[model samples]
Target chain A: MSSLSRTTFASLIFGFSFLYLPLIFTAIFAFSDAELAGVWTHFSLKWFKAILNDEDLLIATFTSIRIAGISATVSIILGTLAAAATMNTPRGKYDGYNFLKRIILLPIMIPEIITGFSILMLFMVIESMFGWPKERGILVVAAGHSVASVAYVYATVSSSLASLDQSMGESAINLGAKPIHVFFHITVPLSWRAIVSGWFLAFILSFDDLVIASFLTGPGTSTLPIVIFSNIRVGVTPTINAFVTVFVVITIILASIVYFRTLCLKGRRKGRSATR
Target chain B: MSKKVVGFFLFITLLIVILQWKVKDDYSGEVVNVYGWYGIIPREIFNDFEKETGIKVRYDFYDNNEMLEAKLLSTNNGYDIVFPSFIPYASRQLLMGIYSKLNRKLIPNIKNIDGIITSKFGANGGDVQFLVPLFWGTIGIAYNKKVVSQLLPGETIDSYDVLFDLSKISKLFPYGVSFPEEYIDILPQTRKFLQLKHGGESVTDFQECFRFLEKVRPYITKFSSTTMISDLLSGDVCIAIGASDNAYRAMRSSKAVDKDIQYTLPKKTGILWIDCLGVPKKAPNKRNAYLLINYLLSPEVAAKITNHSGILVNLPAALPLINAEIVTKKDICQSDPEVLEGLTMGCARAENTRELIKAWSQYKTNTHHTSINKEASK
Candidate 1:
């Protein structure tokens, strides 16, 4: 076992501190009793209690989560299908397949503001023409988020799918299995990890989105970021800090659960192999 | 593996369906959608309105006027009611035909609106028939009393001189002086101050305002609008040019931190800022919007809003019902008739907006003269 050099050690410390110091301070201040976020007084749970009473903030949080969940699900389906279609097709066999690959990645290339604005314009045009979607709301926001995140899901899923051995799927096809059967049994199961990771990525992207959500959100559909951003005009209350602290704690707990579950699964696999 | 995957997806599908159902359940009833500034109106008022009329209020908020304008400009924004500031946003939006002609009959309580604010708004080309100028406040000087007193002994901090006067502001510069982020906040006040000082001839030129600002620009420690309250409370800035409502908030919070924060309407030239309420032209629930607006207009409701939010609502009848703390605080709610009369409402003409924005950005980023001289010499 080799130790890290002094330069590497110092750089690693600097990098971690740079990334985490603000979050650490935010979590610290979340417990402060002072009205001003920057000031530190005594520790208090008043802000945590205040969050429960803040019906608007709670509603916004749920709205954000719902939108993220719906969009992540939609994007995962769309992205997986797009990835399979593009990856399974033999190179240069279809002219449009190459074009499709390039076009699928366009959303990732374009800036989010432009994507939000253009999608908004498209919705307006559709409304004027077809008179459908009568109003922008949660659905419109979810659709907009899916459009922005599907490219990311596609990127993640495709890169992982590309690394898989193509012979497995070919052999399944050779053994008289249908394309659907092969996709479900072989392609999907093998790339399940990538699909799950992609779904999480899309979920986070949609959850953290402010620009696209702002453009598409309508009456009674303000997302969490929109709600928090609006509080800036009047100084942001410490309740938001408490809210964020709670969110961080939940994330850490969830992450640890996943870590231990993976560890347990790995240990079980080792035990099965050893017994065999 | 496939069965587990299928179950996972089914669970997610069920969760989404339940969420969608929950979100849509509230829309089954009659509702009025309001878009306004966050924390301006208390929740109890909305609850009271709901209990009285059985019409639920779906309130959404935006921190800035631009966000509200963006929605209004878009097709079918679905907002039954919106609050836009009078000077630039509501005034400009009115010209774009975004607002519907409010039915005066629906809002009979409109008569309770203060005459002074209405007239002041009207002078700035605000039409009550379209945009109802309801929420109002002043843009003034908010300073740390202890810091300012120590910075300039024997000096009263009642006027803009403490900020605009280069000599006086220079002394406070070390302690830290903050300026408004928006050009509109300070430009009009600067114009008024110059007009009062120079007999209103040479100062009429906007260029003179910029030149005057240039002298004090070097001394400004930071340019901010939203964080002024915390800045004042934290002693980050000894003095800041900010909105009266924010100043009131700072003053209220300052006590908890053991700081003496005071806000003053510039004695010579105070700027009146008004937020107007109106229904978008294509509002889906115009009737409910009218009902909500009228409910808000009632003196008791308006007074409750003012009391809870520190934002002054323009209802003369609500005056007596307002808290003494807000009413007594002359800077927050100026009850003095003479001073109130002198409060000028400033609006940039539609054509001048582009030029004003350009000038403001230039002023914000302009380098110090000495630095410029050094660069030129180099």
Candidate 2:
């Protein structure tokens, strides 16, 4: 590698370390068996044991997973529909479509505090007006996460659609396949990668959130992030470290799965096309 | 092209329909939403009051007081009641200022508050209207006597300085020590160690306090040990600097079981802390809020929490309700005025507050890794 390339590589390594060092430190302490708190000593599975045994933590994690799953699926559907609708529109309507797209992206692009606050206000207003179940806060949070995720899905899928051969759709119709059948057989399957990417984004955003969760959350509705956030002042204990390390490991594993799956799908698509 | 415009019109119409249907559901007023810090008592106290009063209460709590403040400034938050530490409440001009007066006229139970606190801030702030005294206490060392005496045979365990002596520390203790992580309180802790004044809101005596903490750095194993009090009673730790009320609770439970635990107001003084409750200026249910405040301050209610939580109460009259063992301890109420002042000054050292935090942060950053090693080596 050239000297400049070596320097750039070093910079990337430094950047990754800078962002992730604290998390690594936290992981180390999670396994710490030190008598007095502070420095890491000999490693132990004590904290990990405490976390695995916590029924509340497990339940909270389950709730978060269910919420994330529902949100990701919903976001993918909404995003794909919006993208398809916008892509086929006339040149005169492009300005209006872009405006609407910007609105969809607003929730994620703006500060999280602002987005969370506005949604919370909307919920409070609705609660007062309609006397809805107070657990509506969960629905609101899911909606917020999905709305943010939709923009990412739409952007990715719209670009994918732009790259797709439109002649396939025309030929399918000419061959007596109805529009709906063509969509089901061709459009959706082709957009699966974008849909899955959207799902991943939506799920991660909902799970990692703290600020938005804190604002919209009510009694008995605390997600895992809120639970962990509240316990910071209680001081870092083995149980906390164990809980976090497990959470981190699980996220890393799932992210890798998503990454490898995308690569595999892209490879299969390329192989099929090349053979044809 | 006209067909495309027509389709766009249809889409906009659908969006409008959905928005309108949603907007139609919003109401003007139905609940008095209360956002406050949630914990042992603040979590449960509202339930009783909500039941007694017909005004429906919607309450939520954040762990940190700053989170509460942030919510108040944001439009999404519409809290009728906000409970914040008096210091932060005083500092912020917009979110607070209503607390400048105790207005016993509104809350009749104010008559029973501990004179030390209510008189200091209740209608008594220096032209700054910010908070009512909800609760107050000093920071001190809580210890298991057997472990402590064994650790320090000839040397007396009386000052904050003792925490710096590796020779005196207990090997039995798992967590060497713990303190709050708040930036505001960190500085004062250092200055008070050096007999310095806060000077004013900005902090004056921090340098001296910082120097002292830096001096004591290696001796401290960890400061992120808020749960150390619980550990101390379990004998995982011999001693820790903690809230008086936390110590009292540990001792009360331990003594009943025939276990010996002691909490001390160090000879050099400890930190004093206060937690208070107040209704916002634009509270949705102001009358009901006053009623709730009055109800909590009622002698019976106040006494129940004080005894249960073991924290010092704001109402001096409620002092009688404090766990009998803690109030009756002779060592805590020293014969010497100097020692008593030192203990009282523990939380009140406004002088060196800033210096304390700098020292703590520096220590936390520098010696951050060695805490567990020290324990393991021992």
Candidate 1's displacement at residue A208, Å, is: 0.6
Name the top TM-score candidate: 1
Off by over 4 Å in 1: A5-7, A91-96, B196-204, B367-378
What's the DockQ of model 2? 0.12
What DockQ do the predictions score, one after another?
A: 0.73, 0.12
Per-residue alpha-carbon lDDT of candidate 2 for residues A1-276, written as tens digits (9 for 90 to 100): 565687799998999999999788778877777422343557778777766665445645755665565556667778888776766454575688878867766655788888777777777777768755344444566776676667777877778877777777768888999877766667667666665566577778787777777777643345677666655443334576767778789889988998899899999999999999
TM-score, chain B, each candidate: 0.93, 0.72
* Clash totals, every prediction: 0, 33
Candidate 1 chain A, poorest ten consecutive residues by summed lDDT: A1-10
Please state what fraction of the native interface contacts candidate 1 reproduces.
0.78
